[model samples]
Target: MMVNDKSIVWILKIYLLIIFVFIFMPIITSVVFSFNSDRFPSLPLGHFTWNWYDKVYYDSETWDAIRTSIIVALSASVLATIIGFCTAYTDFRYSFRFKNAYLALALLPPTIPLIILALAMLAWFSKLGISGQIWALIIAHTVLGAPFAMAIIRLRLQQMDKDLESAAWNLGASEWATMRHVIIPFALPSIISALCLTMAVSFDEFAIAWFVSGLNKSVPVVILEILQGNVDPQINAIGSFVFATTMTLVVIAQLFLFTKKPNNH
Candidate 1:
């Protein structure tokens, strides 16, 4: 008996469609519910209203969370990118004792579960008496984002041509000057993409922020606190907005930074 290829294709298409819907079911529900005039998330669909968006805009706590998230993400991503690029550049340029071990340790954080890392950071910071400080949250998130950033930038660094650095040095450029002109320029794409990834990770990270944030909280922690007080559609609206924003940033990074080939100058 001959297999019907058209039927198989149709079946696979339907299967994929089902999977997509299943995955996005909650997100779709939230988007639809965000415009819901009624207080409850699900049930009879009510008349469309912008009240939730307006509420989010007017809510001081929501604004505070937004401000905190922005500051933390910016500071953390920049620091992570700088640190990651430097580490990757160093590891790539020169051989040292325990190089493999150092790379392994640097890459370990992304493998560790966030909850475990969060607890560890909380304990460490508590011992240092910095557990409740904003700096503590910033440091934890920087560490959390560094592995991913380093891994990305490291890949670019590995692919780089070593002759460029030699040429710069031959032209009488100092090590730092050569890096500024040659290495960093060649690796800018990867660095930018890594920074974007770090920003998104730091913005969305709840576990570490929650444990170390204490009174000062990022957006996710703030949202959790709001939920504990009441079941509000405003929270859903805020969440959906955040989801959209993060997705946009990821998509932009993928399209503009990752897809394009970096100039190897």
Candidate 2:
């Protein structure tokens, strides 16, 4: 039985390794090709060089897209996190009629098809006379990212002790005081995690941005433009940078999420 278990463990490890390789091989290839001196990716990679990276760095259009993406991501993530915290707190603190329906609506955006969501946002923003503006992209991204933030914060809130708030109230704390002193501190890690995760989501998003971002293009939109024009080596370099940035944010969020102290109660 011991030998069988060891063999099974080895099999699982190998399977997991294979899965990771399948998922990451394309990204690894893009990173490797970004450093290659060759204009086109092929079997025999050209000499290792920084030419592609330099070109992407010096391109004004690339910088503009990156700046726009940063602004939109930062704005959207803040809005999303704020909205998420409020909705999560409501769910955590109260019970009302059609509460399940409220939760369903709160979490529904992410489940909808991105293209459909994008089209709907475009129509709505156009009616509001905000389409094709930076604010439009910000609003659309906020909508897309809010559900993710809510899910993350809600999970963390679920782990909290229900009686902590009651104890605070009993000790002469007002409702707002209990929230400020106890709940926020307890969920701070997850809140930060949600912020990072939502920022990453907004940074990487393309479809909605493409629809609403008339002149103000984000990084992903720029990438698509590059692809549409030609097979440029600069794309590999830019993709590598975007992937690195997004992965960093995801890693930071995951670290905060999983490193929280377990609830004793």
Q: What is the TM-score of each candidate against the true structure?
A: 0.92, 0.96
Q: Write the per-residue lDDT of candidate 1 for residues 1-265, one digit (tens) a residue.
A: 1368888988999999999999999988988998999998768899999999999999998898888888889999999988898789879899999999998998889889889999999999999999888889889989988888888888888887889899999999999899899898888888888888888998888988999998778999988998999999988888898888778767755764665575544
Tell me the whole-model lDDT of each prediction, alpha carbons only: 0.87, 0.94
Q: Distance from true position, residue 176, model 2, in Å?
A: 1.7
- Best model number under TM-score: 2
Kindly report which residue stretches of model 2 are placed more than 4 angstroms away from their true locations once superposed.
Answer: 262-265
Instruction: Write one digit per residue (lDDT tens) for candidate 2, span 54-88.
Output: 99989999999999999999999999999999999
Error of 1 at 114 (Å): 1.9
Score residue 43 of candidate 1 by CA lDDT. Answer: 83
Clashes of 2: 0
lDDT (C-alpha) at residue 218 in model 2: 98
Candidate 2 C-alpha RMSD relative to the actual structure: 2.1
